[model samples]
Structure formats: structure tokens, C-alpha cells
Target: MASQVDHRYIERLFRAYYSGEVAEKIFHSAPEPEKREWAFLRLDGPMVRHVKLTSIDDLHSQLDPPPKGIYYSLSTYEYPDYPMPDKQRIKTDVAFDLDADHIRGAVLQEVSRCKSCGWIGEGDVCRECGGEVRKIQLVDDRTIKSISGEVSRLLDRLANYLDVDIDRLRIFFSGLRGYHIHLEEEPYRSLDSVERIELKDFLTLDGVEIHHAKEPDSAIIRILEECRDVLSEVEDVSVRQVLESLVNSKDNPRHFTSIRKRLGEDRVLRERVSRTVRELCGVNIDPVVVTDMSRLIRAPYSLHGKSSLIKTPLDMEALEALDPPVIALASPSNNMVKVHVDYVPHLIWGGREIPSIHDEDVILPEPLAIYLVNMGLAQGLRHV
Candidate 1:
């Protein structure tokens, strides 16, 4: 719901950035650029799709006033500019999207804004004017850090377990929340949608089955061992004892019957164990992104319209010490801008905590101002 002025101002900023040398450098770094179909989310909200940009100049030409968001197909096609059904897909890079919102225990605040009276708070209706409201989820730093840990785990699994070459993998911050991993190597690129789903199942353990045989699956044993603390939270003392005994049994077939019996008797315990296995041993990734052969992903170094932050590429070392606020620092400007702060959830920026604000004028760095305005939490006034 950003005002027209705010949208135009943000678009101007993006246009300037996209025209600069820095953006050129980043854009050129993209792999196989001409093979993917490009798409843009325009400032006025329509999408321009199935476009092909063969060079940096072609890309910049499309920027004009600059689009809010940029994206490219994961699959390389023979005719990158053609419509989806008509285009012949050559191969698709395997990709994974890990979002902070999908992580358990993420702190979320419901921020609501009334459309009729411009009143903002937390609820379905406005307190001041009793008007219809729109709500959005705001996450804190803890959630981001948790997702970062998951990213690390995923990288480890990809490199060590799946034997993916380190050189072929690319990591990027999605700019809004979470990370995106792209595997551009052979075997992975040629995998069909079904094969991709099988890979997703391996990583997330989405449909893992527990057998009632003499020799327990090593994966189940690993899950039980790793989720010992989670199992301890089971309310039934007998169930907890059985799980603990099973974990100590070293994949012994003798304990399987007892554990199975206990699980069959208590539905809650069965559910708890299944949930724990997924939470502890599996990566919480967007399965659709992994399985979809024709997925479109955020273009690297492109600005995320909602946050005005760049979809930044990162090395393994850089990812280990990544700070969410630092990503915003990569935005085009840092100069102060005055804006009417209508309402904002509690936010952390530039290593400082900003308390929620409502109905006041404040001077903020240009990047922060653009972010707030783009998110419809503030209205632009003028440059300081």
C-alpha cells in the first residue's frame, strides 16, 4: 500500500543503482545469463515476463525507472524468451529455499494497519476507528539466526554427504527472509522433477518410513539419538522410558517391538516422535522450490522491493558471520531522509534496536526510509 510518490521515489533509487558500475559488476557475475528467462516486477505492480537479456546493456535498458524486483528461471532453455509451454528446457539448476518463517520457534508479531482511517496497531480491526485492517508478520533476529544455522547444515550435507563440488554451489540471501542455495553442477542439473523430489525427500526426510523389522534403519536410529531431548518432553513416563531404552540399544531389534508397542498405544507419543525426527534431523526447506523444474528465483544482486535490500551472493566464510542488518547496508544510499512514520513493528537496524513507532516524523538513513516506505509503514517527506 505504498503511496505513488513513495513508489516512484524508491523506483528512482533503484534505477540509479541499476545504472551504476556496482550493479553492472554483480549482474555480469551471474552464470549462463543468456540461457534463462528474465522477469521483472514493475513499480506499478505488473510483471514483465518471458524476457531475455543477452547482455548487461540489455538488462540496464529494461531498468528505465527500475522494477521493484527481478527474477530468472532456474532452468536454462533453448528459446529463453519464449512462453513457458513453448520453450524447450535444456536443464535446471537444483535449488533450495530455506525461509526463516518456516523455522520452528520464530518470533512473529502481527502488525495491523487500518485502510480507512490510517490507524495502525495489532489486531484484525482498528481500535481508533473500527475499520478493516491488513496484517503482516514481522520476525526478529533470533529467527534469522536459526535459519542461518539450517543453511549451514544444508551446506554441510550437500558437500559432505551428497558429494556436491564446493565450486558449483552458490549461496544468496533472499533479501527479505532466509537463504537460497543453487547447485549448478552436472547430475543435479539434469534431474527431472521426480528426481528432484526424491532429493528433497532425502534432505528433509519428509516421507521417511519406520520399519518394524529386526534390523532398524540407520536413519531412524540417528533420528532417535539426535532427538533425545525432544523425546524427553513426552508426557507419558512409560513412553519416554521406552524411547530412552531404544536409543541406548544401539539399533538392537529387541527394543523395536517395545518402542512400536508404546507408539501404537499412545497416539500423542507417535506424533511427538515423528515431529521430533523432522525437527532434529531434517532441513526445513521449501519443498516446492526444490521439486519445481521451472521455478523462478530472485536474481542475484537484485533489490527486493519490499525491503530495499539486495539479494546478495555470499561465500561460505561470509555466510558464517552474516548479519541481517549488514545486508541492508549494501543498499544504494545511507543519507538521511525525513519520513512520516505511520507505524512500524519493532525493528533492528544497523546494529541498533528501533522501538515500534506510530504517527511521527523522523529522519532515517535513506535505505531504512526506503524500506519503511516500501513496506507501507511510513510516508516519504523529503531529503534532509
Candidate 2:
């Protein structure tokens, strides 16, 4: 059963949200069925216009299994500024690659794309036009591996601490440099935008959780201020504003580049925005796992102090002295064994999570209370 919510909780949540108290921690709850309700939104929001969506061929590698992507649902709601009762609520179906692309494409419309630099621009000039875009690795079959190492063990530990059922936790290989966790649990399903934001605000930052902040709202400062210089394009503004702010302006303000509205301005502003986002951001993202739901790409400096991905200075047994990665041997030889990840879902093997079990379990050196999955951890798990 789900927890009973009251007007007060809702009020507090709305207040926090309106005040820009971002709730980036919704993916921490270990709730059973409600787990699915819990998910994460990526800080590196996709640059989309119309939709000729990419294929879902989600990738998983040995050294680095690609970083997970943040997940957000197009919810329906009624706002005070608007009379319409249905708007973007923050709750919707949890889907994967082609599935997500298909659904999101329905809501978005693809426009201009940077043919030279692979930049997804709105109504703007291609990267080659300005000849200013930086170079990136080609997306091919020998995909770029970024995770799938000791990171997975870290995820298991956090998940176990939060008590999220292992079964409902579904991990995905985000097309980018990360992984995505999908929580199919409750109270999560019941959350509206405010509540969802509150929850999101609570867990995972560029890599840390806000609720666990040593200094009040430290996570907020890191996410909204420090990382603002290179986040996503507004779901509303133009690329010119993006460029002006980058090349012309001094500070980068946090905003959304809506996927559906605003085109003319975006086209004119895209070039500059594209430059600042790539050059200055400089791999500015560090994937943070949320209750096995979303993966947020944040500044590593802002979260280096809070990440639970056990440091890589120690070994398995030594790591066990702390929180260890759950490991299970396929046979007595111990040559081929499985690492139990009943808790944490964002396990970073080589900085990314493993999308398949066929790979060997990668444990961190200095571990932290990392829990392991014991058989069918989901048999008794509930669904929200």
C-alpha cells in the first residue's frame, strides 16, 4: 500500500518547487510497486525539435557500458497561471530507447540538425556553416564505453540502503555516456509535479543526494548555479539567447529549451549556444543514479565529495572491510561469478553500468555498505 499524502505535504512541495527548490532526488525511495513511479531526469537534456528518433539499439560494453540517460514523463496538470487543468505534470509511462523516442517524438517535432558537428539544433545554421563546432567520437558498433565497472557495485549499495526492491529496478544503457534506471514502484506513481520535483530534489545530483547534504541546499547550489553554465537548452527559448549568453553574456542562467515551442529564436541562437555547451562544459557531466530510476549528468567537482561509487584504490576483500560489491561465483572456480546488485542500480563498471549480466562483476577497491542480490530478490517485491 502507498503512504497517505496530505494537503500539507503537497503545499510544502509546491512551495519548494515555486521557490526553485529543485527536487532532483525522487529516485531514492526503495518503495515496492511505487518504485516504477520513481525515476530521474538527465541534466544533459536532449536537443530535439521534430523527431526522426534514433534507433533504440541500447549499448552495453565491458570497460565502459555507456552512461544512463535521465528519464522524465510528460504529465498533465492545472496551473494557477493557466486555466487548463492538463499540463506537464511530471508523471508518465517509463519507457526505453526506441520506445521513449517514439513516445517523445509524438510530443516533439524535429527541425534543424548540425550536419557538421552532429549538433541537434532547432532552426539554425549547421556546425559546418560556422566551422566552429568541436570534434566528437563517431557513434558506431564499437561504441564508446564509459561505465560498466566498479560503478555498478556503488549503485547496489545505495539501493540496498534505500531499500528499493531489486526486481522493480530496471537498468538501461542510455545512448549517451551513461545508464538509466527505471523504478516501477508507488507513492512514486501518485506524485504530481511538485511532489515529483521534491523527490527529484531529494536524490542524486551531478552524483550526490540532496537529502544527504551536509550543508543545507548545497546540492541545489551545485545543480542550479555551478552547473548552469552547461546544462540543457530551454524547452522554450532560442539558440541566439544561448549564444548571446555564452559568448556575449558573463553568467549562464538556468532555463529549459522546450522541445515543442520556440523555433526562430532558437535557430538564430543555436550556434553560440552549441559552442559554449561543448567547449566550456568540458565533460562537465558525472552520471548520478537515483533510486534506480534516472541518471543525472552533473559537474563532477560539485559531487566528488558525495559520490558513493567506492574509490578505486582498494581490492574486493579490502573493499569488503567497508561496503562491498555483492559477488556470486558461477562455479567453485570463482573465475566466473555474479556480483549481487540488489540495492544500487547505477553500477558503473568502467564509469558506466553493465546492461547485461553476461559480463563479469566489477567491484570497487574501497567499498561502502554495498549490498548484493540473493537469488530472486524480486519474488516478494511489490509493484507500484
Candidate 3:
């Protein structure tokens, strides 16, 4: 209902980030998609459609106001000008999106508002008024760490297990939230929708079982074994005790009846095992991104309008210790702005603990300043 998005700021960002990248290798090598298919652009209001371009020059020429989101289609075609979707002959690239926001722990705290009575609360429901809820954006440092670890495992699986060459892989930050790993090599690039779905199943460890955890080192085996190891090596006293009971039980632990009956009496023990299994097993990939060949993903190195962070290359070392806000702020020059903070849960940025303050001019880095403003947690001060 209210416009929290700063359209003018987005326009400036578009120009700033993309102006010089027109002639880069990524644009030139993968020129077919940009040349043949349609690209979507989000303008000041709604995303404008049917925006087409033939060259790198055309891209810079067209983005006059700068789009909040820029997307390119994954479907490659012969005579791509055809209006119908079936006409596209080949689909290129199997894309993986591992977003941090999808991680539950990453969402450290939640701010929700009541629809009927405008009651704001700490969680999803309106605790006081008992009304319908709307979510407000919040921060998560843990998810960033968790998702990045999964991404590294994914990269290793692709290279060592799947035999996908390291040279063919292109890994980038998804601007905010997570990472995007694109498989653009031959054979893999031309895979159909069904084959793509198979890839998705492989990465996500769908229908995984204990028998699948044998040697010869497949991704499935690796995932299952990892989960087993985490469970076996758990340090939590309660969780470890429950696992020990399961191990020492006369009945087979794999049997559902045995597992449930042995541990079901204690909800906490069941939860601990479930949580451990969830945390260790499988790569947290967005299924649709891999299964659907026609899906569009955020362009590599593009700026996410919401977070004001660039989708830059992700090195393993930097990814392990990634702080999205901190990385987004480290640049050529400081993006400084003044903000009037309303309220936010403890925000840790640049090794400083920023507490909840009211009506005070707090100098913040541009990325954090804009993030807080967009989250509806704080307002940006004009002419501060």
C-alpha cells in the first residue's frame, strides 16, 4: 500500500553497476541469450515487458531508468523469435539457487503485524490481538554461514563426483540471501526438462535411504554418511544420549517402528534427530530453478534491488565466513547515509553491535542503511 522502495536510488544503482560491464567476457561468450530472447526489466513501478535487445550496446542503451530486477531466459532456441514456448529447441544451463532466507535459523527473529488491528508482534501471529499476519523483513547471519557451506559441498560434488569440470562452473553470490551455481558446459547445457529434474533430485538427496549410503562415493552416499557422522558425533548431551539409546537398542534402528517407538515417547529426542538429519543431509537448492528449463535467474554480477548487494563471484574462503552486509559494504568508496532508527533486533555489522535506538541520526554504510529502510525497520533521513 505504501512505497518503501526508492525508485530513483535503483535507477542510479543500475547505471553505476552495469555501465562498464557491457563488454565483459560473460556478456560476450553467452551472447546468444541476450541477442535472441526477451529480457525482463523492473522499472519504477511494474516490470515493463517485451523489452528486447540485440547487443551489449543495446543493453546499456535501453536501461535508461535502471531496472530493480534484470533477468534473462534460460531457453536457447533456433529461430528464437518464435512466440511459442514449444518452439525453443534447446534449453541451456542447469542453475542452482541456494538462498539463505530459506534456512530457518537464518531468520533469527521475525516481525509480523496484525491485519485487523495493526498490532505489531515479535513472531508470525498477532499475539495480543489474534489477527491475520503480515511479515516484515529481518536479518540472519547464521543462514548465510549455513547456506554457504552447502554451496561449497555442492561445488565439490559437481567437480569430483559428477565429473563436471571446474572450468565450466560459474559460482556467484545471489546478490543477497544465497549463491547461484550455473552449469553451462556441453552435454549438461542441452539436457531436457526430465533430465534437469533428475539433476535436482540428485543434489537435494530426494528419496535418500541408508542403502544408498554405500561407498564408490556418490553425492547421495556422501550426504547420508555426513548425516550419520553428525548424528554419531553429536555433542549435545540429550541428543547424544538419545542416539546412544537408538544405537544400543536390540531392534534395528533403520526400521520406522523401532525408531518411532524407541524415541517417540520423548518429543525432544525425536526433534533433535530430525533437526540433525535436516542440517547435514542434502544441498539446499531451490528445486524449481533446476527442474524448469524455462526459469529465469538473477543475472550474475547483477545488483539485487532489495539488498543492494552485487551477485559477484564467490570464492570458497570468502564464502565460508561471508557476512552479506559487510561484504556488500566493502567497495571502492564508503556508501554513507544517515538513518532515523525506529527499532530492530540486535544488528551486528562491521564488528560493531548496533542497538535499537529511536529518532537519532545514526551514520550507516549505504548497503545497511538501504537494507534497514527497505525492511521497514528504519527510515532514511533526507539531507542529513
Candidate 4:
């Protein structure tokens, strides 16, 4: 809607914060319990003001992990509103915790199983497919832009092609390699290991021959049933196009010339959009894709239950005890922006806290905060 999302503006935003001295991260009060809560949107350095809005969510990931490969880019984004300097950019990389290990540089190795099929690789070849046994890395910095871009583009296509709602299509960054596109439907819980593999088979490669008993048009039926509610919310075609472009880019903000392409495109009139919402409401096959990467976790550990079921807490007193606790103003737009960063885990339902919610709050962990400040300054994006 505005010229606020271009390279020149983004570069200026990042360069300013990254060049300055690192600042303390801050938090605020949400409007009401359901109304509003304060949270930190940690930038490369510190600076919050003049920003229209902000959003930070988990990364899109594959349903399962790959062998000997830990995903580094489980979550990443581009806020033309707040670009990070190169150094801070690398430091800001956040990985989802599927298990206990270093968030960054996670590596998934083949111990005695097929990364793709789980067919125990006791020898040089797998007994199932005889495919040469070798671990494929699941996540890394190199793949972040590519995988994220792919998911964004795919979702755009699915929304436009099937006339589905973009909001209904939840996208996840897999903390490491690629993204996970999950349809917001209850049926997702029912899918088994084999079925998930089947999904991957269908998206990356075509002409899958799933059993007929599942349903004559199970695949087609899956997409429709899961995405029905979304059709009603497709108010903006251009947003979908912008989203698609975002997912397909290997870099953030994409090419300047492409932004011009958006300027020339046609708009979807309100009358037509209203009619489309009244007619459609469902998904056939829930489309999900896992960009090919080396592995999911470098060292995988079994969790007792899904993220929704877990609640780990940190002692606020102890967290505050950590040496430095002052907030820094990284970006000009964020100098006055108040926000909070949560450390809760994903669970069977929405994210649940582990007693830690009330214990203490740190906008960014010391390590992560330092990384952002140091790197941002290194990239000449921070200013004192």
C-alpha cells in the first residue's frame, strides 16, 4: 500500500540500528488479556517508532526431520520496516527447539536409519528402496531464503488456484531447513508416518498412487475440506500475490524491479471479492511441502508430548540476575515501540507456558541479544 517496503528504506533501517551501540530489549503490556499484551519485537540493535505494525511467528517446517541434518532456518522473515545488518542478520537466526541442542548449526546424522524413509540403513544401501544411503542436511543459512520463498509461493498458488483463504493456510518455519504448510483442520492429527511421506511424495513429485480405499478422490478431497473457511477471507488478491512473491524469493524484499511489477497489476474489485466469499468453503487435500534439506536436528531427543502439552518455566528472579538487563534502541521505527518476546513451546493446542510465563521475562536471551547487537553494529546498521 505504501512505498515503505523498498530496499533503500530497508537498508537505511538496518544500517542505522546495526551501526549503533547495542541497546537493551524492552517489553510492554498487551491491551487486555485477549485484548492486548506487551511483547518485544527484538531488532538487530534497538529502535522502535514510526512503524505501522509488526508480526513475528514460527518458521514453516517439514512434518518430520531429515537425517544427520539439523534445521538452522526454522524461522526467518523480512520486515522492510526493520532489516538487519549482515552481521546481526546472521546472529538473529532463531531455530525452533524440537530437542535439547544448539539452536544454530544443528546437524542430523544417519545412525542406522533412512532419513527419508526410516528404513534402517545397516549397510551401504537401504533394504526398502536400495537408494544409496547418505544423510541429507535438513536446515542451514544457505537454504533459509530458498525454502521460505518456496513455501510462500506454494501457499500463494494454492490459495489462488483453489480460491482458498490465505489465513486458513497456516505456514510454519521448521527451525532448520524448510517450512511446513499445515491446513488448519482437525484431520491433520490423524495422518500417520506413512501418510505424511505420501504427502511429500505428492507435492515434490506428481502422479502418486495412494490406495483407492482411502477415497476415490482423497487427495483432491483433502485440500477442499481443510481450506473451505478460508475462501471467505480472500479479500485481497494482491496480498496473495505479494505473499507468493515473498515465499518464492531466495532473499528478502526480493528484486526492486519485481516491486514495480506489482504496481502494474490489476486489482480485484470489492463487489467480485464479496461474491467469491459467499460461494466457496473447503479444502480437498491439505497441501504441505518440506523443502529438501540435509537434516532436522543435529542431536535429536524425544519429548514426552507435543509442544502444546509441555510447559517449562524459568525463574524471573534468576533471569534478571543475569549481568546486563538494559534495553537498547536498535531501529528508528522501534525506538518507541514496546513489545515482548515469549519463550513458550508449541503444544497439542496453542502454545502453552511452563510455569515460566509468570516466573520472569527476557525480551531476548543474553546470547541472542548480544548476537543481534554485535552483528548489527558490524554490518554498519547500528548507530550509537
Highest TM-score scorer:
1
Candidate ranking under TM-score, highest first, comes to 1, 3, 2, 4
lDDT tens readout by residue for model 1, 198-256: 88987887866443324455655655666576776667675566557767777567777
Worst 10 residues of 4 by lDDT: 301-310
* All-Cα superposition RMSD per candidate: 3.1, 21.4, 5.7, 24.2
Q: Best lDDT goes to which candidate?
A: 1
Residue pairs with backbone atoms closer than 3 Å in model 1 (clashes): none
Worst 10 residues of 2 by lDDT: 299-308
Report the alpha-carbon TM-score of model 3 versus the true structure: 0.76
Query: RMSD (Cα, Å) of candidate 4?
Result: 24.2
Which pairs, if any, clash in model 3? none
Question: What is residue 112's positional error in candidate 4, in angstroms?
Answer: 32
Measured on C-alpha atoms, candidate 4 has an lDDT of: 0.27
TM-score of each: 0.87, 0.25, 0.76, 0.22
Task: For candidate 2, write residues 24-120 as lDDT tens digits.
Answer: 2222212221212112221222321111111112111100211212222222122211322333233332211211221111222223435475443
Worst 10 residues of 1 by lDDT: 208-217
Number of colliding residue pairs in each model: 0, 86, 0, 111
For model 3, where is the 10-residue window of minimal lDDT? 209-218
